[model samples]
Target chain A: MTLIMVVDDDLDLAEMLGIVLTGAGYEVDLVNRGDEVMPLFSTQNPDLILLDVMLPGLSGVEVCKLIREKSMVPIVMLSAKDDKQDVVAGLEAGADDYMVKPFDPAELVARMKVRLRRSGGEVNSDLTIGNIVIDQIEHSIIRDGRIIALTRLEFDLLVALAKEPGRVFSREELLSQVWGYRPATDTRLVNVHIQRLRSKVEIDPENPAIILTVRGVGYKAGVPGSFQ
Target chain B: MNSPFKAWRTSLVIRVTGTIVLLSIILIYLAGSALYTQISSGIFDEKLNLSISDAQSTARNAQFQLTFSQYQDKAALKSIFAEILAVPPKTFDNTAREVAIFSFAKTKVRFKFSGASNFLEVTSIPKDFRKKTKISNTTQWGRAKLSYINGRNEPAIVVGHTLKIAGAGNYEFYVLFSLEQQTRTMALILNYLWLTGIALTFLIGIITFFVLRRLISPIRDAARVAEELTAGNLELRMDINGEDEIARLGYSFNEMAVALQQQISRLENLSKLQQRFVADVSHELRTPLTTIRMASQVIYSARDIFEPKVARSAELLVSQIERFESLLRDLLEVSRFDAQAAVLEIGEVDLTALVKETIDYVHPSQDRIILLLAPITPVIVDIDPRRIKRILRNLISNAMDHRDGKNIEVQIKESENEVSIGVRDYGLGFTYTDKKLLFERFWRADTSRARSTGGTGLGLSIALEDAKLHQGEIDVWGERGRGAHFVLTIPKFAGGSIRSRPISAQPE
Candidate 1:
């Protein structure tokens, strides 16, 4: 059974989420306030986190940052605001994905399933893009013999791009393939995550050598020493 | 471009100034003519008086000298005449003196003594003056031309007198006075008058322009500051100097500005409060509504076990709640727009994909009657993706709802500065007047119709507002039974305005 921890400010919505998740064959642990999230989080070690952006004690973005400091937990932000700032801020704060208010329950579960699934797991391999070496098995990037930190979404984005180095990945392609999004899902998600990835892997983010942008198209991996 | 002359044609200041200049020119011309006539008459009067006196004295002296000669021989008379003529006529510089003695036409003479004495050339007198002098033998004086033997001309006054000589019989004596000095003086006076008049007029024009501009500067500044204040720069105020009437006006205007600022800020605070209340109500209601939705869905899942009527009621309840939720969302969005708090997060995206997605969302069935059209390459544009998606979604969904089982065509086109998407539906179209009210909130094409498949009724209005936010436009055209077309034109890049609409409302 999949254990999903749901943190929300409203008691009834938390209970409702628990009911909905339980009915979907998932064990749900309901937490009402944001401050109570970590204590329950450590012991339970839920596979996924359904966090609300606006909370009474600590904001969902802050909790996401705190959780990101310790583990690579898959965190999904639940927000009433579909506004870009809130969504991007949550993503930048280390949320894997987000769902706006009044979202369908079935869709939410499908998003969670996508977040928890691991890629390149059956066959552990090391991938290199530009100067950075990506260890899929270890879930880390080594550049200049130093390990760099990356959010889960950024890691997935990089892995997806690196796996198909020859293919030119358009924003829509990255969105659908990596983010598990349908067409017309906000393209800002792919762009923000790509920027986050470059800052982590590339020697100079201002002049990205790892993810080379194709003019009038999308992005592709740099050919060997083309960056030089 | 407005022509400079045409710009002045409608200006009150130019018209008034032109009228003033024309009237002053007319009045000045009248005064100048009168002054010229008076000066000329006075000068001629002084000239005539001096000329007549000088001529009379010379004539008397010549007659006395001739009468005193006793020998009466021609030689003696001629010598006396020469002596009398040798005394040049004492006259002003402008007066030329000349003397002519002519015997009466009927006067006889001694055979050897017919020599007549004339002191000056007869050509010194004008032919016209000589004709009048010939007609009237009495002493006469008038202005005439005096021409010397050298052919020099001077305006002169001729005064003639008749004398009777002892042996020579009747004689005519005349004096011609030159008016050269008077003419020079009159020319100098005319030059001075012209310079003075021109200088005075120029001075008046300059002084008037500056004085009028000085008086008008405060008003112009007041108008500028007032315009700035109206533009919402409430801190603006007219620059005040010494406490003249204009300064007093500034003081009063500042007072009004303060009042206006206070009133506007007060109203602004009130509006903010109202918006906050609406947002709070929406948030507070939505949380509970979400719980209700979940509960109702759970109940709806097990509806097969319940009675048919109860199951139908449960289904209806679920659908109505979803409708209520969409309405609440739209209302909140509209309120946010009203507060001018809507923000854009811009990114580059292919609009082709967005349109396809919207069509799928509207009609999930594979046999959708809608057609998606695009260019060979991606129609990429920079914009706030979420807003564009919402707009596209609203327009496509509305088309599908009204398509009335007919095919719908969605077209995408682009230009350098703008992009347009036209959604054409071959459905029950609208009337001419319906287009005007199409974007009104909660308006329906037919009131008797059912709620139209879970629409919030604010979709088109919200779409229009969204388009307006991006400095875009949504053009609509519809006929009774022909079809309906809606085209949304936006700039190709964020923060740009649409200059060329790739597609128009008219059918291709």
Candidate 2:
């Protein structure tokens, strides 16, 4: 069974979320405080985390950074604020996705399902973009015979762009393709994640060669040896 | 800074000073002319009196000398006349004197003499004065010019007298007194008068200007302080110096400023408190509302096992919760605007695509009701997409509420620096009087009628605010029994202004 950790300051909201997640056929572990997340996370090893932004003793963004230090587990932040500062801060702290309060439960389940999905049945293929090689079977990328780690969402984003090298994927398209969002929803997710991915994978994050941005349109994967 | 002439229109100091200086100039001119006339006439009369008395004495001496020489022969007489003609000319100590002697036409003398002293022309005296002298007994005096043989002339007073001799007929003797000294004195007096008049007038002007400026500086300070206060600098106050009328004015002005600042800050604190309450209420309600919504959704999903009435009630519960959530969201947005905490997340977007998406989102039934007329190519704009989308949604939803089975048209057009989105409906239109109140919060055209859509009554008001945040304007036109049209125009770039609107709210 897939176990998901729900961290929220409100006990009722946490319990409600547990009920919802349990009903969605996922094993749920409820944690009311952000500080208690790490000890249980180390032992239980949950497949995903649903963290709230405002928490006692530890902020959700700070917890997100702490979690990123140890693992690349999928983190979807739950925030009461739709403010760009709060959302972007959570994203920059290594949250893979976020949902504002009063979000649809069905949509939340759909997003969690996408995050928990594994590519076990697909044929293993090697994809090349810019000067990097993506190993589907190993779930990693290699540059100059060295492996680099990526978050699950980042890997999915790069795979989406690499699968169609000639196509320019708009922000809306990327949001729907990788984040399981409806078309024409929040594009800031795509933008922030792309920046994070470039910083981690590119030789110079300022001038990205792997993710080439098309002005007024979208982004695309760079061909091998495109840059000198 | 205003121009001098323009300041004359707006500044009290300049106008008052100019008026006082001009009146002083006229007053000085009148006083100076009156003084000059009185002093000049007095000096001329004194010089005339002296000339008349001196000529009387000299005429008497000449008559006495001629009487004694009346018994002499022709040679003796000639010597006597020569001595008289050879009298020493006047020096500086004496007034300039010249004499002329002529025989009357009635004289029956053997020797008819006509001679002058010092080459003085005999015709220097006026013929009218000579005629009066010839007929008069006492000395006849008049003003004349003493002309010399060298063509030089001097203004003088001439006194004519008749002379009697024993052996000679009656002779006419005239004496001329020069007026050059008196003329120079009068000119000097005039120069002094002019200097004094000019100096006094300038002094009066300068004094008036300084006094007015001294008196007006406080008012000017009050004006400046008032302007600063009006510009939102509530701390400024007039500077008071003394317990005079101006100081009283300053006191009153400062007191008013203090009162105003207190009132403003009080109102500000109250408004802040109210916004805080609203925000807190919204936030506090959100968590519980979220829990309740999930619980209701859980119940709604299992409604198949319940009775029909319970199922229907569960369905209504879920839908009402959704509506309540949207209302809470809108209330928060309004409070954010009230607190001035709303900020834009600007991006470049395809406006045509955004409109199409909104049209499909709002009325997705696909009955071909909403017709969109836009450019085939993309109309790209820089804006906050969420706010723009909300505005479009509100307008379209509003149209759908009042559309009344008519076709609704959404048009997009662009100009050089601006773009417009116009939503028009031919339905239960509003009256012309309601146009002003269209964007007002909670305002409905006909309050008696039931609302056809699920709206929080803050849509149009929030839409106007959202448009204003982007430096945009929404134009509306409506007529009873006709239709309603709303047009929103915004700039193409962030921080830009709408120079021209691509569409008007009025229908063709």
Q: Clash number for every model?
A: 4, 0
CA lDDT, every prediction?
Answer: 0.80, 0.88
- Misplaced by over 4 Å in model 2 are A83-85, A113-178, A183-228, B71-97, B100-154, B159-173, B196-218, B236-252, B302-308, B335-357, B364-384, B411-420, B432-437, B440-450, B468-473, B489-504
Please give the lDDT score at residue B62 for candidate 2.
Answer: 84
Query: How many clashing pairs does model 2 include?
Result: 0
Across A194-218, the per-residue lDDT of candidate 2 in tens digits comes to 9999998899999999999999899
Predicted complex 2: CAPRI docking category: medium
Model 2: share of real contacts kept: 0.65
TM-scores of all predicted structures: 0.86, 0.81
The per-residue C-alpha lDDT of model 1 at residue B200 equals: 62
Which candidate should be chosen as best, given lDDT against the real structure? 2
